[model samples]
Target: MATAKLKMSEVRGDVAVGVAQGGATVHALKLEGGKNVPLCPTRPKNGLRHMGLAHEQKPDLELCMKCSAIVPTGPVTVTKEQVSIPGLDRTVIRKVVRPVNDTDTTTEEEEAPVMAENTTTADPRDAQVEEIRASIERLPSLLEADNAEGAEELNGEIETAIAGLGGKGVAALRKTLRAERDKALAAGEEAKAAKTPSAEIVNLETKELDDNGKALIQKGIDKVKELAVNKFQGGHAIAEIVLDIRLGITTKNGYPDISADTDLGKKVGGALIFDDILAGLPEEGEDEASDAIRAEIGSIKKSARNAMQDVKVRYVRSLDNSPEEAKKFGYALEAHPDKKPSEAVFTFHGIQSLTRAEQAKQARELKAAEKEKTRLAIEAGELSEEEAEALSSDGEKSEKEKRTETSNKLKKTALKLISDVKGIEDEEEKDEALEALTVLFADLRKALTAK
Candidate 1:
C-alpha cells in the first residue's frame, strides 16, 4: 500500500484524488484509514488522463470493474496518529486540522448560564480557500482587461493561498487559470499576425482544436522557430542541423511534443562545427575563429542558463511577447545545411550533454588530486603507508583494499610479460605471445567466476 497525498474535494462532496509518490503518475483512492488502493489493477488502455476533482471533471473516473466491494458502513475513529505504510520508502501525509463541529444538543434551560468566554473560531484555512476561489473567478476578467501585472499579482496570491491550503479544487483552478492566460496571450499574438516567410512552417494537425487552442499552438511553434533562428550561429553550430520542425500537439493538454530532423557530425558539409572550432589552435591558432567560437559558446551557455531560470518562474511570461520560455523548451539550430540532410532525428540534449561531461571531468580531476595529495603525504613521512591505507578503508577488510590488491597484481604480471616480450625482435612472435597471455587471463577469469 503506497502512502498517498490525498485531498478532499472542494467542488464536490465525498470525492478525492490520491496522488501517489513515484516516477510515474497513478490513479488510486485514499481510504478513510489512509491506505491507498489502485482504482484498477490494470491501467487504462488509453492511459491515465487527468482525473482532477473539480468542475468539468473528466468522465473517465469510473471504476474498471463493476464488481461488488466492501466499504466502512459505520462511523470510524479518525486520529492523527502516524501509521507506516509498508514497501513505500518514504511517506508524507499532510496533517489537515479541520474545524471541530459544535455538538451542543442541550436545551436553553440546561445550557450553562455562564461560560468562560467561548474562544472557538473558524479555521483560517477556510477563509483562505474562499479567497482563492474569489481570485480564480476574477482571473478571466483580469486577462480581458490586459492587466498583465495585476494578473501576475493575483496569480502569485492564488499560488500562496493554495500552498497554504492545498486541495484538488485549488489545483484545478490554477490549471484552468494557466490555460486562460496561455489562450489570452496566444490571441494577442494572432491578432498582430506577424507572419514570417523565412521561418520553417510547423506541420501539425490542430484542426480538431478550437480557435484559441490553435492560436496557442501556433504561438508556441512561432516561438520555437524564432528561437532556432536566434540561437543559430553558422561557424560554431553543433550536431543538430534543423531541416524541419514537427509538433504533435495534445488537444487534451496543449503542450507540444517538439522534435526535429537533424544531421549529426563534427562538420556538416564543409562548415566548421562546434568541436572543430573548439580544437582551433592546431590549424587556426589564437585567431578570429577561436575568439568567435569562445564568444558563441559563452552566449549559448548564458541563454541555456536563462532558459532554466524561466522554468523556476513557472514558464509563463510576465509580458506576452517574451521568448525566454519558448527558448527554454526548444532545440538548438544550425545555419549551414547538412550534406546529408535529415539523416537522423534529434531531441533536446545538446547543452545538457556538454554540461554533464564537464561535471564528470571535474569529478575525475578532484578524485585524482585527492589521490596525489595522499601519495605526497606518504612520501613526506607526514603520513605512513599503513595509516594512509587505514584512512582509505571502511573496516578491517574493505572492498577498496581488495580491488587495489587485485589491480596491482594484474599490473605487475602484465609488466613482467611485456618486458619478456620486448626482448623478442620479431614483431609477429611478440604479438602472438601477448595474444596468448590475453587468452590465458580471460580463461582464468571465466574459471574463477564459473560458480
Candidate 2:
C-alpha cells in the first residue's frame, strides 16, 4: 500500500516532474539491446512553468516535459520540492526564505547566496486554499478597506486590521482575486489578461545569472582537489579542468612583457611569455603521444570558440538623439518612409549550449579523476613535504623534472600563489586569482598524490 503519493524525484534521480513519495517503485526500464534509456514518465499538465529544473540538470534525465490536456492543475504547480500558485493580477505566491533584520541593506561587497535547487516543497495549491480560507474569514475588514480607498482615517484602521496577518493575509486577498480571474478565464470573459503577466510582456528586467565559474567556485574549491586527481582512459574533460588549472596557476604579476616605447618609457606593453598552453605536456616521452593529442584538442576547442565570436556578436542600435542624428533619421513624417525601427535585444543561446556541452566534459573529467586516483594509488606511497617543496620550482629552476616535471611545478606554483595572495591589497582581484591557482595546484596534485 502506498502511504503517500510518490514524485519523480522520489522514484529515481532521473525523473524530475510527476511522481511523489511512498508510491510504487519505478521499475528499471531497458531497451532491446539492454542499455538503460532515459524515460520521462507521464506528468499531469500544469500551467505554471518552473525553471524546469530543481538543480543543475542530471546526466540521466530529460529535464523538460510536454503534457497535453491539463484541465486545471488544482492551483498547485509542483516541481520537485518547489511550488507556486497564481494570485491576483496574475501574480504568483510561493514559499521563500523570509530574511530577518533588513535584507535589502546588503552592500555590493557582500556576495549573494548561491541559488538552491528545490530540495523539497509543498504544493502551491495549499497556499491558495489557505489564502482563500483566510480571506473568507476576514471579509468584513477587507471589504472595509476596499470601501475606504482614499479615506486616510479608514485606511489606518484597515492597515491595523491586516497588520497582524502579514504576508499570508495579503496573499489570501490575492488568492481570492486569482480565483475570480481563473473563473473569468474558464468563462472566456477576460481572455486577453488570462495569459498572465509573463506572456504579454514585450520585455522584463531580469537578473543576469552568474556564469558557471562563479556559480561553481566555492563548490569547486571544496570538491576540485579530490576530483582533478582522477584519470579516466577515454575522458576528454581533462582539458577543461586543465584550462581551469592554467587559469589558477597564472599569477597576477603582469605577464612578462616586451614594452614598445617612443622616446619615453615603456608604452604599449604586450605579453612576452609564449602561450603556456600545451605546457602541461609531460616533457619527455618515448611516444610523444599526449603532447600531440593535447595540442590538437586545445587548438580545436580554441578554434571553435573563435569561430563563434563573430557569429555571436549582434549589434544593438546606438542611442541617438542629436540634431544630426534626427536629420538622418528623417524627423518629419513625410521625410522618413521607413517604419520606426524596433529595439535589438541581442541574445545568444551559445552560453546555454556551451554549458550543456561542458556538462558532458565534466562527466568525463570525473571519470578520468576516478581512474587517475586508482593509478596514483599504485605509483606513489604519498608525497612527502620535502618532495612537495622540491617540486615547487619557478622560472629556470623548476624545469628539471622528468617529462612530468611541469605538471608538478604547476601544482607547486598554485600553492605558492594561494599563500602569496593573502597579503595583496586588493581583495577582489586576489580572490579570483587565488581561486584559479587553487584549481590548478589541486589538479596537479592529483597526478602526484599517489606517488
Candidate 3:
C-alpha cells in the first residue's frame, strides 16, 4: 500500500509529490526516458488539494491519522503557545527583507526622468559618451597593432582626427600650401613644378591636359609637404600640429619652434613654450642673425604660423559647453597639458547630440550579422548575390524544406513563451511573448540571407 499526504492546491492541474517508506521518493517513473522533468499531476480527484514533496510528505514524519491540516509551505513562524517544550525559546526575527530599496525613489522634480528630446540639450558626459571617446581614441592603437591589414584601418582614424580639429589649424595649413604653390608659380613664369609625375599623391591619370598636351602632374611640393609629420609640407598644417602634440613636442602656442635656443631655454623653455608659441615666433628673429638663410628660415616659420592664424580670422568657435562644462574642460586640458584639445563649437545648449551607446553597438552588430549571413550564404550556395536585402516582417519565404523548418521553429518558440508563465495574467504574458518574438525575429532575419 502506498502512503502520501494530501496538501492544498489551486485547480484541476495539481502536483502530487511524496515518498513511500525507507526515505524513497517515487514520482512519475521513467517511461523510456531517464527522468520525469515535472511533478506528477495524477492525484486524488479533488479540485482544491494536492501533496507537496516537502515536510508534508516527509516519509518518516507522521501525523495523527484523523487530523486534517493546512500548513504554510513557504515560510515558517512559531507562536509563544507552541513553545511549551521546556526551555525552547520561540523568538523569531519577523522582518521581511526586501530585495530592492523602496525608499530610494527620487523625489526631485528637476531630476525627473528625461526623454530623448531633453537629453539632446544635456551634456555629453551625462549621456554614455565616455566609452565612445575611449573607443575612438583606442582605434589608432588597434590599427597600429593590426599593421598587416591590406588597407590599414588607422587611415580612417587618422583622417577623422585630422578632420575633428576644425579650427585655425586647417586654415593655416591651407595658406601654407597656397603660398608654396604661388612661390612654385613664381619660380617658373608658367612652368609648374614637374607636372603630374612630380607628385606622389597627385594622380597623373586624373590630370587635366594643358594646351601643350602635357599632363600637369605636379600638384606641387606643398602636397608632399603635408605628408611631413615630423615637420610638415602636407596640405594641412593643423594635422602637423596635432601630430607634433601627439609626439610629445613642446608646443608653446601652436607652431613648432624649430629655431635654435640655449640649453637653458630648451630645459626651462619647455615649461614656458605652450603659453606663447606664436607670440615667441615673430619676436625672436628681431634680435637674431640678419643673414639670408636666417631670413629664409624666418619667412618659412612666419608662413607656417600664418597658416593657423588664418583659420581664426574666419571662424571662431567657443570651446566649452555649459559654464560648468567649460570650467571642467579647461581644468582637464590644463591638467593634461600634453593632450590634444577638441575644437567643438560651444553651442549655448550642450554637446548638441543625443545617441545611446547601444545604437553604435547595434550598428556594429548589424554589420557583423550581415557579413556573417553573406559568408554563410556563400558556403551554402543558396544565393547568387553576396548582399542580402532588408526584409519585410511578412516576407514571401519560398522553399518547402525551409518553410517546414521555419514553421517548426516558430511553433517551438510559441510553446516556450506559453510555458514560461503557467496560467498567469494574459496581458503580462502577451507582452513578454511579444518582446521575445521581436528579439528572435531580428536575430533570425539577420542570419537568413535574401535567397
The prediction achieving the highest TM-score against the true structure is: 3
Cα lDDT of model 3 by residue, 328-446, tens digit: 24534565456433332222112223223444677678877766776677679876541233231224343554678888998998788666644455432344345455666677788
Candidate 1 root-mean-square deviation in Å: 33.0
The reply for model 3, stretches above 4 Å from the true place, is 1-127, 147-410, 421-433, 442-449
Residue lDDT tens for model 1, 1-451: 3222222221122122322221123233322222223343432222222233222234333222210021111111222423222212343342222222246465535532211111122222344445556676676566566666887787776665444433323444456445654565565444434542333454453548898988999999999998777774331232212111113222223323222222221122223433455665444445786666666775664444334322222212221244453443332213212411111112222212223345578878887777788899999999987777766532354567778999899999889887997788644345445655676778888999999
Candidate 2, which segments miss by more than 4 Å at Cα?
Answer: 1-94, 97-416, 447-451
What TM-score fits each model? Answer: 0.16, 0.15, 0.17
lDDT of 2 by residue, 231-274 (tens): 22112343333222332232234211111112111111111111
Give the total clashing residue pairs for model 3. Answer: 17
| Top candidate by lDDT | 1
Candidate 1, which segments miss by more than 4 Å at Cα? Answer: 1-124, 166-451
User: lDDT per prediction?
Assistant: 0.41, 0.35, 0.35
TM-score comparison, 1 vs 2, better candidate: 1
